[model samples]
Target: MKLLYTTLLVVVYIIPAINAAQCLSGQYPPKPERLLPTYVVNLDAPPVERWQDLASKYKVELKDLIAYLKTFLVEISPELQYLVDLVDTKLPAMADTLPAPYGDEMKGISQASGLPLGEVVLYNIFYEVSSLCTSIVGQDEKGNIFHGRNLDFGGLMGWDKINHTWALTEKLRPLMVQINYTKNGQVLFKTTTFLGYIGSLTGVKPGVFSVTINERNIVKGGYIGLIEWMYNINRNQSFITFAIRDMLTNSESYNQTVKYLAEVPLVAPCFYIVAGTKPGEGAIITRSRKGSDDVKLLGRDDLWFLAQTNYDNWKKQPFFDDRLTPCIKCMQEKGKNQVTFESLYNVLSSRPMFNKETVYTSIMEPATGRIEAYWQLCLDEEAPCRPW
Candidate 1:
């Protein structure tokens, strides 16, 4: 009887603990050549209906997707309570400030995904709240100005258990959602992003401009109060990437984009790369967490290449992101006067700069409004075998 009881305890508790340990400690497999397949979503219906259709279509992954995002937030935010505080307190006002169409869209995403409106709002601002990236905006030998970047965030950080398990269980794949807007009727504005997300990080407006952002830490600025933070949330009633989406939708030219980017309000300080089809229109717009008055702009009318890594080159401070030198050197040696789409691709995919954490790589030909993207470098199957 004693032996049986001991055996039962081992079977019920010890074995399960060992299994859980194995599952948690499991190594991630190489990313498949693609994360998610590409798909197009038209925002032509009422915001709720549009998001509802999107949610229903992707219902299988919605729960896991939220879990995957939560793991990252739990790892990054000061504490889960801070995020909860933001959602409980600031989210409503932030949502209220959104152009009605976008707010309705958020409601739709929340309703369809069965996620609380606060979670949806927090997820939409994830990058704004925390992110890491590097971007380049300079002209090739042929006067072709291109915008290129590698989005680097915490990938293999312990959040893997959630992603790996869910991915395996669901045969899950990543997706690039090409969003088309119907706000003013037949707008040329379009953005490509992950499925279940509703903001622009890297985007372009054909015949207008291309834009991307890099994070700027506000450690030196000290803590900001919630009331003060929300007050500075918008320049023309948009926040974070929604501002980018709005600009791409409404701005018709590079100058117009610069004006909007300059005037835009943000809850955080960040580095922006804006490239235009016209000569002398491309620039790096530096944003302050405070307001537009503190905003700064820099661009070159004459340069074979223009770029920004993680730090503020405009301030000429002693600080520079570790990746800056390698990126610049890569462009000069491999891309020099021979800078072509292929060369840009090579540089982004080259040593020092490229790594396991790189989620995606993209190059935009603003002059022609064309974009070439390679998703999942770790599992690079070279889906985009050719670059124009």
Candidate 2:
């Protein structure tokens, strides 16, 4: 009955749309047709000049995100002036610590768009300091690997209360972009990211592996720590997205990928979910700021599938904010016959798992090097179903 309902829903909403209402139930809206733009970066091109083309293509997006994130990051600024002062003068000095191409990439973007370098630098690290997400990785009966995720970024400071506002998410729709970093015309890796942001929460390397990062909340209200972490040049901490980019750039196999993710010293805590072409090539690298607390792999001891939300697998999630249990249950119920991409999408698109803050959904099959992404629309849909 559920399968029939979903099939019908997909068929009925087959018309191409940007804000269509096609619910699997009251909550799950499957396969939104909103496609994000894909761009290729020439690795041979100078890092500071590579993104100059994109800067022109998304001039407004570049300008708007900088403006928005300035307000967003400044609201919680500890001294406020400290945050303002850093962006204004110190961004150029961050070169030694922030990896090579990233600093140059942002510089390219700033120069092309004619936007302030300070705000552009701050915008790229937005996810480094904060985000919420859910991810699942599993193997089919045929031993093929599949990965999926929902990226949830919410933090709008209202005068009375900080809240999850859809205005930002809706405004974020057009900013979605896929970056294929290539060398000599061969693609090295791909990232589903925003136009100007260099780092990624989701990415894949064909025939190699796929990775996604989820914000792991260890300590509550750690913005002060994050503020210090980003500016502390001596910490030698890896920006989470840059770490993912590094692994995709360097690692040749799944084992090496797991090892790298576990060993890297991150500037913030996160859940790094990885899947590869081989059968047992999936793991969730649960990380702390300095080291990995744990690494949970799929296809181990018959654990065919693994799901991660914002919390660690060993700890009990608070009832008021539990998406892990339901997501796992959904995966188990839908992924029974054959672990197809649609099965993973069904689990990811289910209620509670697919909430108001979910900005986008991604489904990946690493074996064939196939990946698909869709913007989850939160327009005037029914109550409890809308992202708003």
Candidate 3:
């Protein structure tokens, strides 16, 4: 009886254990191994002609081209080490900023270039090459391949599809704008706007002007250039209308914002007139500092009427034909006499939104209520002034 009981207990536990082992094994699968292809080359022969011939004969996959380049780098590692040493010695004097930690510096570089930090760092180490090297590494629809110019491992694979360029190239341009507003050295607004105002200005329906406050930072000197660029691009009221509509309502990614606006009609002419205020003041003063003391607000009612009138006049006049000149000469001529807020409004209000401006303001004036009023017009699609 004792032997029988012991045998039954052992069988029960053994069965459960076997079943548990099977279940566990089924739950966790083995990890798949990473496989990359190998390329064989003959060192005895001339290499340049051989690569050219191969590229001509076959559609080399981007992956295979990268691997080939890596092998080539390994062959010339010693030479590359010497060059790196030279660079390390010379770079310190040229760089104004101290070297950031591997991680932090990479983060900063990525933020600056608008590229993925990891990819940027990798390219900086392995694929640092001359423009000649870039030209040599012919780009195909699939990938790029190259021989050494600055170093052996100079070829980069996997060009970003969305950006349609190497990750490193993307890192060359500043991706974010940092604004610093200070009050007698006390920081007020120090903030970063990604891709800065470019995305906002360009992504909107083309000619519409929109204003955003970076409460953290106030640029004391840089506002003039920004305003000028805004004026140049947004002189058309229809474009302004479209830009405003998309900016307020569109959900597309910033990259696709231009694509969305491309379809919209460029209508009402627009310009940017920026004004700044002291830390405590609610008043807006023009970058040009030409506004009257009583006109404190940036976009007051008087300015709105002026912009509307300007748009109306702009539409009525002969479409300015001087595409080559930096400033529209005819448009400026029309605006010359109409510098004051009241004069601009009086000229513009006489005509419909679509009618061209017969008169132009040669001297630039501050943008006031017109900017906000146009925005309001956009909000109310039913407004009588809304251009179809």
lDDT digits (tens) for residues 114-231 of candidate 1: 8777767766666665556768776755566778877665532232333321121122235445455445365465555666677788887877799987776556321232334456
The alpha-carbon lDDT assigned to residue 240 of candidate 1 equals 62
lDDT-based ranking: 2, 1, 3
Which RMSD values do the candidates have, in order?
A: 10.7, 8.1, 30.3
lDDT by residue for model 3 (1-388), tens: 4345335433643233222211011111112221111122222233222223222332223223323333333332334333333333433222222121223433444454443333333323331221100000011122211100000011122223464323322332222222222334432222222221111221111122212211101122222322232345432222232243234333223223323333333321122212211111112211112212121231243221112111111234212211112122222333433233333222222212211111111111111112101100111122211111
Output the number of the lDDT-best candidate.
2
Give candidate 1's error at residue 41 in angstroms: 3.7
Error of 2 at 295 (Å): 1.0
Q: Which whole-number lDDT from 0 to 100 does residue 28 have in model 3?
A: 12
Clashes of each: 4, 0, 49
- Poorest 10 consecutive residues by lDDT, candidate 3: 145-154
What's the alpha carbon RMSD for model 3?
30.3
C-alpha displacement of 283 in model 1, angstroms? Answer: 0.8
Residue clash pairs of candidate 1: 35-174, 36-174, 36-175, 138-306
Cα error, candidate 3, residue 244 (Å)? 34
Error of 2 at 29 (Å): 10
How far off is residue 279 in model 3, in Å? 25
Error of 3 at 166 (Å): 10
Write down the lDDT that model 3 would get: 0.23
Which runs of model 3 end up more than 4 angstroms from their true locations? 1-87, 95-174, 181-183, 186-326, 330-334, 337-388
